[model samples]
Target chain A: MGLQRGVCVIGAGMTRFHHKIHKDKSGRELFVEAALEAMESVDKGIERKDIQALFVGYFTPSLYEHQGHIGPLVTDWMGLTPITGWRTETACASSIAAFMTGVLAIASGWYDVVMVGGVEKMTALPTEGVTDALSVAADDDYEIPAGATFPGLYALLAQAYFKKYNMTWEDLQAIPIKNHHNGALNPKAQFQEEIMDIAKRIGQREGVTFKDPLDFLKSKYNRVIAWPLRLFDCCPISDGAAVAILAAEDVAKKFTDTPIRVAGIGFGTDTLALHDRISLTSFASAVFASRQAYKMAGIEPKDVDVVEVHDCFSIAEVIATEDLGLFERGEGLKAAVEGRTALDGDRPVNPSGGLKCKGHPVGATGAAMIHELWKQLRGEAGKRQIPDAEIGLAHNVGGTGASCGVVILRR
Target chain B: MVSGSAAQFLTKTFYDKLKEGKLIGCRCKKCNFVMIPPRLLCKECGSKDLELVEFKGTGTLETFTVIHVPPMRLKNVAPYVTGIVKLDEGPMIMGRIVGVDPNKPEELRMGQRMQMEVIEEDGKPVLAFKPVS
Candidate 1:
């Protein structure tokens, strides 16, 4: 919601997302991998010295990785020392928060070329420990003390959406099904196989006959971590990193003739506690952020050809589509059920799978979404490309919709 | 019967009564905001001039979730329903839902009337809600 200076992504990169405990690869190692890949993605090789500043996004590395001062550490590891660097954190939206800061800084004419990266090194802790670390993003005194986990919090939203819209569990299943279908096409996706494969494996292991995928999804194993949400609905705890190079629009042509311009950017925040929110079905932050982005881009929901929304939970994508104004209130699940958000539908969403399938590495997820959008808009997303995608949008949310960032790109 | 932790510190006399199927909230003298979970201080006015008030365990279901997977402590109780109930006394409380089918999303409607039932969990009386027909 400021001056409309143009910014373009010159390169993008990411490390393979996985559980890396014994390898001793820290968050900095992951960031280096992604930064190298991004440098390689550029047509003309970029020197480490060319990066004027570095922006890093991370969450709970102090707890999980036992490392802090991630900004300078990543910069030093990437051999971009002497360049100014800082870390931005907003729980899961850390990477996007960094990306947004880089954009704003460039727009303000503070810097010409900048590198943005997000990294999260979870999986070093046990499942319960991870849950406890993530719960810190909530209202610690009120929500966490009452035994509210992220899954339980989102489950409340899912239940409210279902109750208000007359939707069934089947409607929610459509999200995982669609995301997994797309994830299978992505080489870097965490869960690259279809859900039916999981079902078959479980059936064989348990010596029980699973009638179909639907039955498998509804099985006790997939049952809710918090009621109305099952294991399948949640994004996996992952360790990954992503990087993108942003340059002022005037010099963008020097990198790539076909550059995707940062058409719009918006961000908003809400109360940390769910109890203070007026509606459970929609996030006020996302609505406000998307509006800001749309207004800045001089576009509307109708102008968006493709979207990559935060599907940290399967239900999140449903609420995001509605909150982004892609569909009217209480109609997001219906749109999803009707396949309107499918790859070949009117408005393709999450073509690179999503956080649900592509894996959510907290800080990395926001930058990863932008990386996917960059590839799609440049017509480089093989097998998962939306046809003639002139405009694309990315929505990233942090901690049960407490913080949200929306970015729009135009080719 | 209260848990060892609750028994270790009998800070509020009403907490002892809550274990006997009594619903109690704290009313602040300044703002008159009733806290269902019974806060030590008023959230609105930050007043410690609080008094305990018994609440009728009746309300409406504002929202709810059918938890298919539970935490390790509640693993045996998978497929349980939990919800935020807006009590008649003007306080929202999060608790488990009893006497309902978790799989039946159709049955869990918002604004549906609910009545509270106190169940023993870890030797402590835990309050829950049940849909009223």
Candidate 2:
């Protein structure tokens, strides 16, 4: 079955995802900033009174900001009070769920227009506090009791992949390097400098020299957070928000002459712990969710021109490409190593530099992906634009492989 | 037949058995699927008809990683090895790997036989595994 009444994205906007830049801003302010940008993005301009409702995806507000009841809180902040508003949570995929909820509400003929977005004020806490807060998404009784951190959970997947494919840790470095190159071109990204540039700058200050990015990565500067997964291999914590405006398909043109149609929406969940799954080489939730989305969209993996998958870690991107059927199993890493997943590659992935360099504000990541896709499809993604991008997809996952959401959009 | 209903297959029960020098799991009476850290329902067939079962404390190392940065509670035990072991009883579980050098991960081999051992961390009983030469 398909959407009863179609929904289209008329406008989207996001703040530059970074750690230090948004240090003083709270989640409410970050969301309002993104919402204002989204309002400005509307071609014909829409008013707050015209919007029917609101749906937000903000994970760990209580832990990060020591606040709850953020749905009405953000609604009031945006001056859209008295309109029904609420929040959704699925760990990192929270906003995708919110976006899908907005889609369903419109498709069900309940509302003609709605605003969907995600926000996270992660920098409010220290690194360790953030880590503890995020780990709550996992199986607390099982996974966390075994001393598994986020990096360590992914490290296990990398280890299994290396053993099955006979690859090495050095093979995964291409991901961070390529993402950094893409991030350099994205003003909204957290780390805007290339890996080699950062390496050289650090080397000059530390009284050390390196031959290249790989050499610098192998040095002590990139200390191992988990064996086979170093500092650069992990995404840094950042604070940001993303907002998108959705309109019923028939009335989409009232706000914009050109609107991106929501082609497909799919979400799936698996066991929380990795040990309970059939295999560690791939995320079954992503596979299941993407398959459903492709079927509903009536398209094949080859039809996707550009994509933004969750790259919370380098190896995660590798597994995501495979799970989405963009690359064959055990071939994702090789694709990255060969520049096939670069901005100018045959199968371009994460044109926003991914969560790796774009920065992972956790809750904001899912909608931020949609923000990138909207820019790409509209020929508005300035430097990292994929030429003539027609069909775009976004894959978002929660803790480990427990939850996933796959969304497809077309111009 | 193992005593107690599916209610006995709780988290505290599993850890208590480990503290008593016994490694226990649960088997679905309907599907015969075994799972570690005992659960009330079977993941394979959605059957609550489960019974407690004892393991021989042996398995094969499936995958592993050395955690150089651990959670706050595990801060004192940084740079420790954690892995998933495919137990002989047909279910896999995650635990710490001891009796080996955490820094030298290249020395470890997949498919190597392992023996389960109970260890204390943060004043709580935690499962651990050691390589069986």
Candidate 3:
């Protein structure tokens, strides 16, 4: 069944995703910063009392900050108490769940206006600590004991994909190259420099020159984290937050004339461990979730004007494009190489630079994807904007495809 | 050997059998579905009535990766090979792929036959696989 009542996002906001910039800020402070920006983004303006309730998604507060019970704490911090608030989590897809929860609340007609957002204070912990914390999202008793890291898990998928498609690691380089190019245009992106520029800088410091981005990528400086997956292939550990203010259709215009409607939202799950999945090249969760979303939206993949998919690893973007039906299976890598998924390409994926260049603050990533789509749909995405973009989609995955959520939005 | 009553498809029980040089899995009586690192219920049909079965400990290498940046727990064993094995009985599981140079992952090929090996890590049995000529 479709939503009982129409729901739309009137405003969205996000802090620049980075590791060091937000170091002095706590998760609560970062969340409030984003929420204030969201409220300010409303053309008609809004107040704290206008929000009826709140939903927050934070993946690992306990391990990262020795904290829990974030929902009420953030509500209390925002001074919007007693309005009913809680936390929702599905690992990296946490904030999308929060966004969906807010949509459901508005659709239920229980609350006309509510706040949905996510926050992650990942920089508090060291890299190894972050790795150990994120591993909890996998099956601790099984996958973790088998020595599976997140990148290693995706690398296995890359291996299977390469063997199945007659592709090589060289074929996947187009993804980071394109994303970094897009990231160079997005001021909020953590790495706002093109790969070649970065290569030139590093080359000068090391007294070496590179012919192209590929040469720099293949160099020892790009050192392997997992076979076929290098440092540039992964998203960095980051700290930030993103927020979206949602209003029911009737009252949405009171907030903004160009409200982005929540046309379709879908979520799905598969076996937690990678070995249990029927296919390694594609995520069953992405297929199921995107299918549900497309059915609800009554639109095909071609109708989507732009997209923001979870590219936690470079290989993931290629797989996500196919799973979401943007490209045929085994054709995703080729599409990336041909620039079909570039900013100016027919199918633009991750114009906001995705998690790779955008910096993935896990819990905040899903809502942050929404933040990018909100800008694109409203014609506010500057420089990296997709012209005449009316319909946009966001795909977020959690824990090696154990959980996934897809949201489709339109102007 | 552990008592039959104590074999309830628990992780401890699965590893205990691995400690004894045996790889035991479970098959659901209702759906005839088998799983390694066995579960209390069948994933296919959700049946609680299950029977323990031993695997031949052999399968094909479906896919593999060499982890260069190891997690803190496995730091001393950096650059270890891990892969999924499609067991003969139809269930697939993850384990270390040994008997090959981790530094030379190019030597590995998909669909190669492999045999299971139980190796000890921190005094506890851990599952692994090795290529068979």
TM-score of each: 0.85, 0.98, 0.98
Cα lDDT tens digits, model 3, A165-213, are 9998988999999999999988889899999999999999999999999
User: What's the TM-score of chain A alone for every prediction?
Assistant: 0.97, 0.99, 0.99
Better of 1 and 2 by TM-score: 2
Q: In candidate 1, which residue ranges exceed 4 Å CA deviation? A: A1-4, A20-23, A204-211, B1-58, B66-82, B89-133
> How accurate locally, in lDDT, is each candidate?
0.83, 0.92, 0.92
Q: Ignoring the other chain, what TM-score does chain B have in each prediction?
A: 0.86, 0.93, 0.93
- How many Å off is the CA of A243 in candidate 3? 0.4
- In angstroms, give how far residue B127 of model 1 lies from its true place: 8.5
Question: 1 or 2: which has the higher lDDT?
Answer: 2
Q: How good is the docking of model 1, by CAPRI class?
A: acceptable
TM-score between model 2 and native: 0.98
